[model samples]
Target chain A: MRNIKLIIEYDGTRYFGWQKQPELRTIQEEIENAIKKITKEDVKLIGSGRTDRGVHARGQVANFHTNSRIPADKFKFALNSVLPFDISIKESTQVDESFHARYSAKGKQYRYLVYNSKTRSPLLRDYSYHVPYTLDLYKIREGAKFFIGTYDFRAFMSSKSCVEDTIRTIYNLEIIENGDLIELKVKGNGFLYNMVRIIVGTLIEVGCGKKKIQDIPKIIESKDRNEAGHTAQPQGLYLDKVFY
Target chain B: MRNIKLIIEYDGTRYFGWQKQPELRTIQEEIENAIKKITKEDVKLIGSGRTDRGVHARGQVANFHTNSRIPADKFKFALNSVLPFDISIKESTQVDESFHARYSAKGKQYRYLVYNSKTRSPLLRDYSYHVPYTLDLYKIREGAKFFIGTYDFRAFMSSKSCVEDTIRTIYNLEIIENGDLIELKVKGNGFLYNMVRIIVGTLIEVGCGKKKIQDIPKIIESKDRNEAGHTAQPQGLYLDKVFY
Candidate 1:
């Protein structure tokens, strides 16, 4: 028996999510099936995290156990060929028996894309939130600065979330602009479900003059979801990287 | 009747192409239908150029005649509300009676996106071409430099294209990189049918060391299309902007 770790990428548009659910198309189930077909053994793949429908990933980590003639490094190419075009294996390596994709991760990074223009771009429809207003970029930058550090992010989490701890440490956050595209990059030791989306929505409000950049600290202290910004559209968020 | 010029954006994935075709869904037909819904008038939009099926557009130009009560500046907002999210009007302005979308355009810009990495990105399945091999950037740049002048691009067009004059000025051609994303941005007065894709395909070959950079000028000088590289996949090419 051997364990394999994979660097994964996926377009979550047509998927139910990362986890397997009955009668639903999922990233996890697909990867498992691909491995089963190759190894003739049912293998359970452990993913770094779950992403909601219509979200995306650039570098998601996953691991599985298998007993097959195929080498670990060769799994990337084999699985990629069998996987759907929207899901791919970037890299695969042999791992210890105790290695777990989700449990062994030290931190994660996410990016939310916003297209700030007077009109929406069809080219970016599935990948970005369109805001047809003048954005105060400086205020948004200041707001991003406020998010860095340890905080109880209960105010930013969705009520539907089932995580145990409300406390998380955001290591870094930055808003970068490239033409009309603005990306909100955030890294943290842990995230509350929908925390990134809520942060993006609140920061956008700050950019649009509906909220103050300095108000984020107060909202975090309040520990009430209503005190934070609205949850942003899911299509704009991406799991950029999962660090181990 | 007032003539309105529009900066249009479209997801050409579902449409037959940019032009009107009775046999299939078209970008022109969809926009016309949206206009008829609001104005109760059948209208045909003339686009700056035709794009192939499964292609995309970021800043396509088009024009139509309307005597509707909606203001010209408000046309984009009004039309966007009714149009599919994948097809949108980015901007609109009342144009002179003599202005035509196709004829008045002085130049056009197109971009071909390539995801250069060891693994394919699932999110970019339809948005870019995935090349897993490491690319030699300097070699690709050298080949790209050959395309930056007025020249007859007869060798670069596909046989299916029907254009009498192949002489076009390539004002600028550049390859830009950001992380794993690489964009081949080219602005020119005009392009031969499949010219951009052919150039991009050739550049990729050069980047991968499949072809020599010095051979590009020789291929361009040849009048036969067979002398050029194969046309790159259509999905990665975008009609980025049209200048009037």
Candidate 2:
């Protein structure tokens, strides 16, 4: 059997998410069905992580085992020919037997777009969160510094998630502003469910003077779900890259 | 009656062009319906120009005369409250009584996006033209210069157009290359039907070695539509700005 690694990109506007459900359309199920059509075998695809519905991905990584004689690089062309226009295979290569898509991943990077303008932009409606109020970037930047180190990020996660190991390390967080668009790029070793969105939501509160710049540490230390701000919309989030 | 001017933006993916047809969904018709809902008057809207199906606009200008008592700037907020998410009124103001959207325009600027890569991008599928061939930027730049002056651009237009005065003045043409995306920004006093698309297609042929760099002037002098390359797809074209 060959262990095939794939890098994929997708527009998640119409998808339920990266995971497969019985009746809903998903990215993983579509690719797995395509693989079955090409290889004539049932293969379980392991994704690096899960993205909520309407969340996009630029470099999602996945791996699956197959008993086919097709060349690794040619799988991209074959898969892309069958996949829908909203999904594309960027690369496909063979890996060693021990390679695992989820376990072997070291870190991940996420990008969020915020459209901070008085008037909503039709072109950016599907890909960005529209915030029609004045924001204090200085306050937002100051508050973001608290999320750069290792800590218990239980408050930043969704209350529905019950993962026991809530300690994670964040390497870097950057806030970039261009015209009416504010972009947030974050890199971390691992993330809890809804972690990045909650962080962005907290920063937005700080920017709008709803929360104090000095309160981020307290919110993280509390480890209480109610201590954090609301979760940002899923459409503005993108799974940018996964490190192996 | 008050003459009102509006600067609008739209994501034209679902629209059947800017003009109104009896049974088709168009930007003009949608805006006209929204206007009637607010002012309860049947008024005619004059657009700066017509954008073909699937083409977008960032700063399309239009004007109309109305007997409503709504303030000029307040119309933007009122119209946006009732309009669909795919169209937006960026600005609205009262203009001089003699102002006409189509007749008073002096020049226009357009932008085109070309995605040049081995793999198709799912994120840019609706807004960019995908070209899987390697292009030489130097050759494209050289070929674009021939279009920077006044000329009879009959060959660059669609064969169905019957405009007698085929002469137009091009102020500037720029080709910007960034990674796998090539951007073309052109400003001109006027353009014939399908002129920009044909020009882009011809320049692409030159970049890919399908057409020679030295044959641009002769192609223009021929004044034959077949002498030029194919018309580029409408999805990659954007009406960027309108000058008055």
Judged by DockQ, which candidate is best? Answer: 2
Kindly list the per-residue Cα lDDT of model 2 for residues A1-244, writing each as its tens digit.
Answer: 9999999999999999999999999999999999988888899999999999999999999999998999999999998998999999989999999989899999999999999988999988989899999999999889999999999999999999999999999999999999989999999999999999999999999999999988999999999989999898998999999998
Instruction: Provide backbone clash counts, one per model.
Output: 0, 0
Q: What DockQ class does candidate 2 belong to?
A: high
Task: Candidate 1: count the clashes.
Answer: 0
DockQ score for candidate 1: 0.79
TM-score of 2: 0.97
lDDT of 1 by residue, B98-214 (tens): 999889889999999988988777888788888889999899888999999988899998899889999999999989998888899999998888999999999999999888999
In CAPRI terms, model 1 is classed as: medium
lDDT tens per residue, model 2, B102-132 = 9999999999999998899988898989999
Quote the lDDT for B65 in model 2. 95
Model 2: share of native contacts present?
A: 0.76
Q: Which parts of model 2 are misplaced by more than 4 Å?
A: none
Instruction: Assess each prediction's global lDDT (C-alpha) against the native.
Output: 0.90, 0.94
